[model samples]
Target chain A: MLTSATILSALLGGLLIGSAAGLLLLLSGRIAGVSGMAAAALRIADKGPPWSQAAAFTIGLPIGAAVVLAIVGRPEVTITSSVPLLVAGGLLVGFGTRLGNGCTSGHGVCGLARLSPRSLAATAAFMGAGIATVFVARHILGAG
Target chain B: MRHALPGLVVGTLFGAGLALSGMTNPARVLGFLDIGGRWDPTLAFVLAAALVPSALAYLLVRRMERPVMAEEFCIPQNRTVEARLLAGGALFGIGWGLVGLCPGPALAGLAFGVWQSWAFVAAMVAGMWLQRLYADLRDHRPVHFTG
Candidate 1:
């Protein structure tokens, strides 16, 4: 299932992602944490400085994705989870990202790059929990 | 106008990266998480690749007095390892494992024009709002720390 093209795509995509994060930091010194951006952009958080940047980034996420799809066409995507599970997942992610102060983009990438011990701890915590959840749900419970 | 332009461009690039890497697909994400089963190492590669530019940028930032556009580099200053951080991360991991959709991918999924993506995003937004409300009620200050 894995091909050289796929690996190349992953590498290219990853570099692009890193570039976006680096660009944002270089230009404005903001962490490209999607959850934080969404909270500020949606006006769910108290309005303050640079909220507009968050709004722009949030809007651009979908627009940028659409642009890529237009150029490259859609890839194989199968959402195995039901609607209820997605909702549950969404709620957990939303609350958790805020409570922890970052998501994959924040703690997993930028934080680690910056050599923040907090990011390391947070990333490890989430990865461990994620792996455990999958083990339990798929192996023990026999549920997908 | 100046404030928004960089964010928009960078965001577009970010989304394109996610799409190109196939990270937007929940199934692929699940494949990565399900190491107990048929594992896919693509995400590991993505992570390693992503760290390259990011690490260099951070290193570069150290030499520069300030960001090009911003007056100063704004980042989290707190280093205290709070229990809330671990608990919250764990909770987020559970959600991510369940659906293999984090905030970024879910938001980017909007471009897929899939109902599931929309649903996940809506719920995620609501969840964020709920957390904001909870924090507001708990303390007068807003939660903006990223440490």
Candidate 2:
């Protein structure tokens, strides 16, 4: 379903994210660190990300999609997995975020862009695990 | 104060775009990684989506004399190659290759209500926890980390 058109659509998507991060810095004196926001969302009471912030962040995701769909149309998806595996995966990521003190966005996008040491470490861990998982799944377990 | 709101708004828009573009969907991501099989080409799009804005941002920031938060532009200080760094990188690569989602895409995926994205995220957190334990045990030894 993807072609050069899809690539253009993606560039647009990345621009949206980079633009948001820039705007956030310009307006709020804050970095659009997903890990920090997410951690706050999970750990803090109402103190977590402002309801508006969370809502906006969540809503923006699909809105970005709407924009793409308007331009590039749609893409097909293929997956074969059990619900149990899915649930297990979500749980593991949540745990990793807590341990790492940030998610990829916090580190990879916002943090690394800012030249943060902590972010670099966090991103490295995130990618390392990702690669290892792929190797084990594909080569060892032979699972997709 | 108001400027900050733009980031939040932009973030939402970005996330939504990712979903609409199929970047947030693990299947699309996995397909891209499946070079050995069908070899879907969506990942290329995702990287492109990320690269352009980032490059522009770097350019813009360079033009600015100062950032909003600090007097000087942020720059990386650490330049080390150590064991812990290698270990962490390895872990991240494995996780990414297996699931086709990383931190940026994972958060975006969370909004789409994809079960697999959620799972990848959960496991990612666990890996961080294990790292922390090792760090504490090592008493903050020279742990290598990269961006």
Candidate 3:
């Protein structure tokens, strides 16, 4: 259903996301990438603002969702994959984001905004890979 | 504490955006990915909306001497495209397609208290730890001596 409300929600949501990233950079000198921040939250050895700040940001992710839920009610979320599939996907995401140095937010959002060639390449690769995976899973494998 | 306060605010906003944009919904995300099917272009709009302000933010950052809260910006310095980048991206994409959930949404979904989100988060953390371990081992590998 491609309604005006959907479009408005997406646009507003995107603005909020961009504003958060922008503010993070302007205020804290950090890229608002979830994977990196989450990893930093687990870094026991690293000290200083980076560690505590990362931990705080990570904690806030869920809180932000909670706030949205409080206002707009719970979102409709469907989990179709089995436990094994979910676990495998999660592991890959975690490992790949770390190895690749960023995920959608870091590479797709901030990196593209910066006009970094590496980010462009990474984004292309991931998007291409995502399209191929979907094709295989849905068309070829008949999973979807 | 001051530094962390900013992080918390940013994170909250980010999460709220994810939920509001419907990124937290796996079905919606899959709709976006399903170009061959009934595709949903909502995610693209979200991306565009996000890029506009973020691009502007970078422009603003260029004029500033330093962040308001930090001494210096900790931006990524690496420029070269390496094998790791391509491989990792490919792997990440595959995972994203399978589940339609990325790190941000996965964490945000935790607020719903669903078992699947919890499982995914736990596995994700394990995967990160595994990567660190692998990197450590590779870096510390003993050099071989040729006869």
The numbered model that scores best in lDDT is 1
Q: Write the per-residue lDDT of candidate 1 for residues B1-147, one digit (tens) a residue.
A: 767998899889998888888889988888899999989888888888898999899999989998998888887777877899998899899999999998888888888888999888888887887788788778977654421
Going through the candidates in the order shown, the clash numbers are 0, 65, 0
What value does the lDDT take at residue A33 in candidate 1? 85
Residue B122 Cα positional deviation in candidate 1, in Å, after optimal superposition? 0.8
Q: Is the docking of candidate 3 incorrect, acceptable, medium or high quality?
A: medium
Residue A6, candidate 2: how far off, in angstroms? 2.4
Looking at model 3, the pairs that clash are none
The sequence of per-residue lDDT tens digits that candidate 2 reaches over residues B32-51 is 65655566776555544554
Superposed Cα deviation of residue A3, candidate 1 (Å): 1.7
**Proportion of native contacts in model 1?**
0.76
The global Cα lDDT (0 to 1) of model 3 is: 0.85
Model 3 C-alpha RMSD to native: 4.3
Off by over 4 Å in 1: A47-49, B140-147
* Least well predicted 10-residue stretch by lDDT in candidate 1 chain B: B138-147
Pairs of colliding residues, candidate 1: none
Measured with C-alpha atoms, the lDDT of residue B83 in candidate 1 is 94
User: Which candidate achieves the best DockQ against the true structure?
Assistant: 1
Clashes of 1: 0
